[model samples]
Target chain A: MDTIIQGKAYVLGKNIDTDQIIPAEHLVYSLSDPEEVKLYGKYALSGVPPEQGGLPQGNIPFVTEGTFHSDYTIIVAGPNFGCGSSREHAPFALQVAGAKAIVAESYARIFYRNCVDGGFVIPYETSVPLTGVIKTGDELKIDIEANTVTNLETNITFTLNPLGDVFSIVRAGGIFAYARQENLMAQS
Target chain B: MAQTITQKILSRAANRKFVDTGENVWLNVDILLTHDVCGPPTFDIFKQEFGPDAKVWDPEKVVVLPDHYIFTANEHAHRNIDLLRQFASEQSLPNYYDVGTDRYKGVCHVALAEEGFNIPGTVLFGTDSHTCTSGAFGMFGSGIGNTDAAFILGTGKLWEKVPESMKFIFEGDMPEYLCAKDLILQILGDIGTDGATYRAMEFDGEAVYSLPVDERMTLCNMAIEAGGMNGIIAADAVTEAYVKAHSSKPYEIFQSDPDADYHSVYRYNVRELEPVVAKPHSPDNRATVRSMQGTKITKSYIGSCTGGKLTDFMLAAKILKGKQVTVPTNIVPATVLVARALECETWEGVTLKKIFEDAGCSIALPSCAACLGGPADTVGRSADQDVVVSTTNRNFPGRMGSKKAEVYLASPLTAAASAVTGKLTDPREFL
Candidate 1:
């Protein structure tokens, strides 16, 4: 895994819940079917409309029609990101929607673990609020080893807490890979 | 060194003498739970990661219950249960509770307790976030994703970080109208939704211990709403009696040291606390019921792992005994056992279900109906522009049925009373 990552930032506000990430209606999809799993990417953030206390009206889709976009790789958000539901689909949907990393003030515990264990996305915790500092389409560079997120658009830098052992799992490409590498799983 | 109960349990699970907060360690899981909503996905991951020939590490430890979307007649919803049935049959799992069968359990959380899987001083993980509800038994209960659950399914172990502990001591005598639900809402209001993020909320002191185990479960059930890793109470005589009657599993009871270190300590006087409600859009947006009185409601829901326990219905039945609900009100028992108990048990002379039915409330089957805003046919789902007072946990936009519908979260007393007046009403007035 690269120690430094650069992408365009998409900003969201506080208390972005799992229902908003992927509504209960979409939860009926079968994960075994590749076609159904792809629907998660398409419906990612589907519940977040102006009427549902999300981005004001007429906002562009974060993940356009389930197609991964290299431009929208980073998501910047305020505190309590992924606040409701224990669904790993929230992070999985964000991953399938082309989110390489998430920079938030704080995250709900289950979402944080899901992102790390599933290698869905790199979760970055920052003391400084990122929602106000970063904007949509801002070029952002995250340096994991240096514990800093630099906004190339404005030339401003923000400090981030090192994820410690969690970074090791991320570098190994999810928990299954890490467990295999560590010989935690007995060879069949 | 004095260790908190959270620390003690983690150390045991990790097989270490001591584990500090923020340190990650591999933990051997004791109990793992999954339901219809997440079970099929977890099984898919299990099969994808581990070959079809691979068997579960321990079939007895993995429990499968179809609860969340089972009440609906949707084909997709029924398909999830079919997958679980197939998987359980293939694995020969002894704990699978199939829907519409003699072995059917209602909600997974309630079933876990009734089946005695919530043994004290053990680590419990579930696919649903409210898995923290087991913490009422003094266990380290937390929610895990499908992938992690799959890993545990195959290997019987997973890695976890030791969380810091926050002690909340509720002092003074609790008021009659106030339940554990009100106390927790007050705590949520004092500390915002993320106040206890990545930390354990250890509830204790006079007021908490004075309540019944069912009510204590309600407190732990919503700890996730505050972003708490888990909510726990030390196993005392009350807990021991309940566990002994429900389960035969051998268990060790653990307690926090007298001088254990906590990240922070909050002391609340329950005597002055009033009945509170979590207003529209947020669980932490709490206000006293008295202040929010007369806010009209179009529906009333009294069910979920959080508020569908036997105690919750008993309280609601007390308020709705003779009065008819002015709006559409739905009463769902949390489990089949609870449903049977409701049918057989009576407060004065009338059965609990009779009390609810006589009050013009529709009693639904024991399932997670309308809690997560089920299919179009789900009972008690609010219509667009409708306002509902529900006993379920979250009240976010579109949480029930329509994004345009508003939801107010309150205790069963408040919900039942609100159903009578077609608005938010204080339970004390009816009492």
Candidate 2:
């Protein structure tokens, strides 16, 4: 059963780097306690730190703190969702942060597969013009079975297919569950 | 009448057939790679995907490098290393690269290129996205997920949709101290991070002709950082010189036609670029270091698969002579060879290793160690207020340690200068 995250899409218009998605700092940190590592944590506000001058003051609302974190599911990105190191910790953090699936105009192939393998839904090919279609807080439904996303507020229905069987493994709750069911020996 | 290098390679790999635009198809994988952190899971899934007696799809096509766990502070990482060793022995795979006696063989991509595993006219994929780093040799390479990596290991093949190609024509000479690192940073900053997503980046131009293979590699390696498929240069005298110097194995050359189709064209007159930097939290954020030089860095690291080359070492050693690093620095040569080359003092006037170590810069074994903040490398993002300038790609927050930390991207010279001053200063200041 594909779950529908009933919240508006927090959209980033362009140029999303992997560093911002799952920063290198969070890579080893998540191994200790994944729940603590949110994809867009408090640092999203201040451009990451005092050193980087933080984010734009008005953009604080866009940080995952006050509003971005509440019930958001589908992250509609411009393109190239996963572009940096082929670090699996990337998609792992995205899944841990409660991102149900991602709807992008296009996805980095490694990122797409990592999303599917990590039990997070990432679909693309632009079923609809991503530009101007999504607004923050527009409730959306993603039916995993049919591999389609419906923007309830805008009445926009987008078609997509998960990245092959990797989706099935992820849908089963990470690769561990799929491997366990299939008698796969997961590393300790 | 015109076929791009990518179309030609993908077509040949796909049974000598011609491919048109927007066709949903899968192409053959030329090379497959795995590292320490990602290998255990792959072996586990692969073993389950096929029964015990399952022979590998093709042993020669696979490459295993124990880079992630070359050394680790945790026991779990140790156990993973053991498991990888067990997997290698059970399969009788010979291409497996453990931390051998070789010094310069650290990161898989660097080691592969240095040791001549990456050849021209082939398709390559590594579990690491930086696999695109090998594309400097004129090969099609990509980074893939574990599932795809596992599938390739089981069946010795993977699928791909033939991608669009973009032609980058560069003209003029690259300035001194302005190496391939600057070229890549410039491209990433201009095109945006996702600019080349799913497209084959073909590096062509007279300025490109001026770049050495390693510099070209930095360009190709960072291709994936822009969400590109592969970054390649049309084979030329330099490539031929590289192949002749590096390998005795016979290989064929791959080229593109003059009228080859491109999704778009990016023409840069080398005379046009200025020093550039990708601001923190994203790779595409661009500005001149001159614009943002007001900030200071607590740490400056100048070695990785990206910057830890012989020339990189020579350049660093030359600059750091009689100079001291302002921060606690570590110039980790990604491979034993680069480390040894630095140690030998053969190429430069000063011993690079001694200059680095004498200046309180420790030479740690290459293990993608500090790059990910494990053990001795934990960045105090929340703990320390110091910002870091690094030569390694990706300046995501807490990349060095704490979430509150800052990372500034720059060339080796810039990083070396920052290391000396504990601030984001230019190499010219030190010189």
Top lDDT hit: 1
* TM-score per model over all chains: 0.96, 0.82
Write model 1 residue lDDT over B1-431, tens digit each, in one string. 78999999999998988898888788889999999989998998898889987799899999998898877878888999999999999999999998888999899998999999999989999999999999999999999899999999999898887899999999988787988899888889989899998899999999999999999999999999999999999999999999999988888888999988899999999987889999988999999999999998999999999989999999998898988999999998999999998998887889998898898989888988888887888877777898989999998878887888889999999999999999899999998
Q: Which candidate is the best by TM-score?
A: 1
Show model 2 residue runs off by greater than 4 Å: A1-79, A92-99, A116-139, A143-188, B100-104, B346-348, B375-383, B428-431
* Native-to-model Cα distance after best TM-score fit, residue A25 in candidate 1, in Å: 1.6
In the predicted model 1, the residue pairs found to clash are: none
Off by over 4 Å in 1: A2-6, A51-58, A63-71, A143-148, A155-157
What is model 2's DockQ versus the real complex? 0.33
What are the DockQ scores of the candidates, in order?
A: 0.65, 0.33
